[model samples]
Target: MYNRIILKLSGEALAGEKSGVNFDNDVIKAIVGQIKKIVSNGTEVALVIGGGNFWRGRSADSKMDRCKADQIGMLATVMNAIYVADFLNQDGVEAVVQTPFKCGTMTEEFSKASALNHLKNGRVVIFAGGLGHPMFSTDTITALRGAELEADALFFAKNVDGVYDSDPNENPNAKKIDEIKCEDIIKNNLKVIDLTAASLCFEQKIPVVIFGLNEENSIVRAVGGQKLGTIVTV
Candidate 1:
């Protein structure tokens, strides 16, 4: 459980009940509805979401240079941020979408001071665009943002239920870990979080919650102190 937290959502989760490369209003509204419950309970929130639903740079780089694809991925994240910010506004929650990379029309430039000011004002901040650089995933951004915000915990909402010894979908008998130390995670080379992200949390001692986004009430369960997922701590 955490007081103030950073939530990392993958883009595919925003796709709603269809298979496509576009934004879904109903899905956004549903996410906002869930978040409202937490904010009403006086929790400070920040988020970092990926853009895999629209475009995953690596997957599209058949002819494009790696750097170009990564830049395209960053832009995709900015697009998601704009959509999220607009949806939050419609939900009556003051949300600020900030990016480490400059996207004047979509969001403000990211700065810890500005983000803090917004949080102090009870505004939910959506950090997007993955540290304004290429080659790093949003997971890395989540860990860095967690440290910068001094968040009690980082919630990673993935498609899987929790950290497994192997891909749960691929390996039906993969062991799900309820709790584990960060060092062991690295030593075992578990992909629960990337090495960079895990190293940051390991150094900072911030707990990371890995849970399935598809699970009903999973986000609330994590925020409500329910031990329903794999927790990585050191």
Candidate 2:
């Protein structure tokens, strides 16, 4: 089992399959339950949640300034972190939201030391605000935080079960890659993660697991080394 891990959750996973809703309570609760199980087993966890559920900067109108749109995207992540942290706390799990930028008293400013301290003390640390800058996705933040915190592995709780040779939705013959290297992922330009994030994971020698959030107890199983999805290694 991984002693510590950084779990990257896409905002869309929080929304599940619901349309016109910011969150799916059942999905969030199920995820929280799995997290609680892992924590009780003594595995430390930190999280980086994406903002695609609320907004995607790249999907914004062309008339909007790119930087401004990204700023709004960053704020959307903060909102997600706040909601998840609150839900975790309410479920009797201690969780804290940390941001790269200030959120007036809503969240703590992120620092490697502080985040590590929280994990060591059994508090779940949620890193939000997407590196506090534009042109950076939360995937990049996940790799960065995993490196900074020396996590045993990075867990990507995505909508898909694993990385595939082609888009599974489009190609019926697309094969799920059970294991892969970061260099190959980058060289082949796979969509498992952005190039920037994959490069960082390679440089830092961080192992990553990508799994479907909808799978039963996926997070817990992934951390326990069950090989529920694709495993990416340096």
Candidate 3:
């Protein structure tokens, strides 16, 4: 089992295909239950959730400046982090929300040492804000945080079961790759994550496991080393 892990949860997972509402409580708790099992197994967890559920800044019309749009997306993440942390606490898990930008009592300021300390004390630290800047996706933040925190592995609990050779949704012949090297992700221009995130993980020699969270027990199973999906390694 991994001692510590970063869960890169997509905002769509929490949103549950809804367009208007920000979050779906049932989906959030279901995901939390999975993490609860892992935490009960003595694993430390840190989460970096995306903000697509609330806003897609890049899609908000070309009239808006890119930086301003991205900043709106960042605030959406802060909202998610706070809400998720509360849900975790309700489920008997201690959680803290940390942001790269200050949120005035809503969350603690994020730092490697503070986040690590929370993890050590058996609290799930939820990292909010995407690298505290615009023009960066949450995927990149996931890689950066995973490296900074020295996590054993980065768990991308996404919608897809694994990395397919092509778009599985579109291409019926697409095949899932069970195992791959990090460099292959960069070379092949894989969509598992952005290029910057993949490159950073490769540079740090951090292993990434891309798995579908829709399956039962997927989260705990992955942490326990069950190869249910793509295992991207060094």
Candidate 4:
């Protein structure tokens, strides 16, 4: 079992399969339940949530400034982090939201030392704002935080169950790789994560577990050393 881990949750997963919604209550509840169980089991957990549910800067109109669009995306993630933190707290799990930029008292500014302290004290740390810069994904933020906190592994709670040779939605023959190396993922352009995030994980030698959040107790199972998802080795 992992002593500590950084979990990356995409906004799309929070939004669920339904459109025209900011969050799916059932999905969030299930995720929070799993987290509570893990925390009870003595695993230190930190989260990095993506903003794709509210906005995708890269998908914005060409007329809009890229940096401005990304700023909006960052705010979206802050919303997600805050919501998740509150939900976890309501469910009896202590959680704190931290960001790279100030939220005017809405959240605390992120620091490696403070975040580590929070984890050490059994508080779940939620990281938002994606490195406080444009053109960077939350995946990179996950890698960065995992390295900084010296987590045992990085957990990718994604829409897909695991990494595939091709887009599984488009290609019926796409094969899921049970285990893979970060270097090969970068070399093959697997699209499992952005190049920057993969490079950082490789450099830091951080292991990653990629799994579908919809699966029953997926996060708990992954952290428990169950082989239910793709394992990405550094």
Task: Point out the higher-scoring one by lDDT: 1 or 4.
Answer: 4
Off by over 4 Å in 1: none
What tens-digit string does per-residue lDDT give for candidate 1 at 1-234?
A: 356889998888888668764767777787887777777777888989899888887695588888888888878887887788778888888999998866766688989999988887878899988977778989999999999989989999888888888888898888998999998888888887888899899999988899888777788878888887798987
What TM-score, computed on C-alpha atoms, does each candidate reach? 0.95, 0.98, 0.97, 0.97
Compose the digit string of candidate 3's lDDT tens values, residues 73-184: 9998988988999999999999999989888888999889989999999999988888888999998998999999999999998888999999999999999999999999
The alpha-carbon lDDT assigned to residue 78 of candidate 2 equals: 94
User: What would you estimate as the lDDT of candidate 1?
Assistant: 0.85
Candidate 4, residue 47: CA error in Å? 0.3
Best by TM-score: 2
Write candidate 2's Cα lDDT for 1-234 as tens digits.
788999999999899899999999999999998889999899999989998899988585878888899999999999999999999999999999999888999999999999889998999999999888899889999999999999999999988899999999999999999999999999999988989999999999998899988888889899998978899988
Every model's Cα RMSD, please? 1.4, 0.9, 1.1, 1.0
Model 4 TM-score is: 0.97
Give the Cα error of residue 15 in candidate 4, in Å.
1.3
Please tell me which model should have the higher lDDT, number 1 or number 3: 3
Clashing pairs in 1: none
- Model-by-model lDDT, in order? 0.85, 0.92, 0.90, 0.91
